[model samples]
Target: MARTGRRPGLGGTRERILAAARSDFGKAGYEGTTIRGIAAQAKVDPALVMHYFESKDGVFRAAMQFPVDPAEFIPRLLAPGLDGLGERLVRFFVETWDSPAGSPFLGLIRSVVGNEDAAAQLREFVTREVLGRLARALELDQPQLRAALVASQLVGLAMLRYVVRVEPVASASTDELAAWLGPTLQRYLTDPRVTKVNRRSRRRR
Candidate 1:
């Protein structure tokens, strides 16, 4: 997988870097993952990572394999504050995936079922870039689990509507879906009752 002999086109080397970067980022999160580490994972020189991605941020962008940058967009989404973050998140998720721009994600998401590497990359990106960030922003207890719960909501919605194409749920209006889904997401992100219950449950065990 190392590009040794003559310089190969961007076709192979680039794909390799993306795959490696996704794996490391998925496992390590952003802060823990490094360019050198990704290069090593990809079986290529560090120079190649820099060459292909320019920096850690660039590598992360490519690894996410999504059209929108959740790191950038998430903060903006929460700029109005976390009061309606669940609604905001659902809107963003619905709008993006339903739009033409989100077309690629359908294929990318489908790949996750059978493609472990792709799935890892996606799982990391959503957890770190989207759900992880959301959890941290809430500043609540068990941010990791809270973020994961939120991610499950969005992912499940995507699978049901876009992938499975289930009736009623699949054809529901975004507003209707958001109204129905947003409250649960809101509770997951900010409800202290659930948090306290979960914490106590952990203690009992």
Candidate 2:
């Protein structure tokens, strides 16, 4: 039986627009790429690009698709009754970074490395799409700080391994690194002493 609604490839103009936008965003950094360029590349109208994505940032976000949404990822990472969560979190990040899903992520990171405009764009994307959203979803206290620490851990490791390709650090297995680094992140994520004052207020609740 044939299902109703738009078929996969025949989803019409919108699919075409996204396909073009992805290529443009990947080849060109967030700033370097434009809606006009995407429309031209996709052989569509500029209006269509705007129609689908709303703006360049929207196009980039859609282009660099993530396997896991932050709403799901953060809560799972911070789930109660899960001890040694730091290691699990590190493992999750390592697996994602090493997977095929991470290619677009790496591309975005490389784009941010040198250029100021690209860096700013990347920062906004990371803070809003990746970190801030996760914090909001998880109800994590001091979301900005937690997100920053999480980013520091993941990004620092990515640089050490993939970018700089440092010695033992680069070659180290994910489990090995997790063993060493999990406690540090665990402390950041859940240490009572770190938020002693805040914890006192929560206790009053």
Candidate 3:
């Protein structure tokens, strides 16, 4: 009789799942991809997928080769209660990209430049995991706008410093970048001026 349980010696099952997951995520994006779909593509049991990755986010992180788990990292960044968060955020961002672990992130950014699917996936990840979470943490009005503003700053900085390799930004030390960007981030997160601007813009409409 044939065996009815999990296949023994599943040597490449994990790798297969990861490959399938990457494909699915690239095509369907974070919100559209599902564990069952990934398992189907991988030719593995859903149970096996869960056993290996535990959850969809786990699979995403593994497949993407994320350097740090945002779920944990975001909370830690928030632990200091909003004081100097901008500097801390900038410091962390520069340090992470400077390290070997940032290769995957750099690859994703490069892909986003030319690939719509890659761009969508990145937008979703940033909206849901990064911007959305930060907005929620702030517990203030116009969360979406505030988050977008903050993202704009960081994204431009990243493009200039890493992709374009432009002037002083590219050569600047992490400390300098943090010092320059931190206050801006802090303002976006906590300043009443941001809300005032939004209100004024709305009044014009």
lDDT of all predictions: 0.78, 0.69, 0.82
- 1 against 2, candidate with superior TM-score: 1
| Candidate 2 Cα misplacement greater than 4 A, ranges | 1-58, 64-68, 79-82, 137-140, 195-205
**Candidate 3 TM-score, true structure as reference:** 0.85
Candidate 2 lDDT (Cα, 0 to 1): 0.69
In the range 116-158, model 1's lDDT, one tens digit per residue, is 7667667766776677777777788888878888888888999
TM-score of each: 0.73, 0.63, 0.85
1-205 per-residue lDDT for model 3 (tens digits): 0111224358878889989998999888888999999999999899999997788987877776555677778888989898998888898888878877666767777777888876876787778888888889989888888889888998899889988999899999999999899999989888877887534444443
Identify the runs in model 3 with alpha carbons over 4 angstroms from their true place. 1-11, 198-205
Weakest 10 consecutive residues of candidate 2 by summed lDDT = 1-10
Worst 10-residue lDDT window for candidate 1 reads 1-10
Residue clash pairs of candidate 3:
none
Name the candidate that leads on TM-score. 3
The deviation in Å at residue 61 for candidate 1 is 3.7
What is the number of backbone collisions in each predicted candidate, taken in the order shown? 0, 0, 0
RMSD to truth, every model: 5.9, 8.7, 6.3
Writing each residue's lDDT as its tens digit, candidate 2 over 76-169 gives: 7766534787798888888877877666666767767765655765676678767776567545568678768878988899888888889898
Model 3 misses residue 13 by how many Å?
2.9
Best lDDT goes to which candidate?
Answer: 3
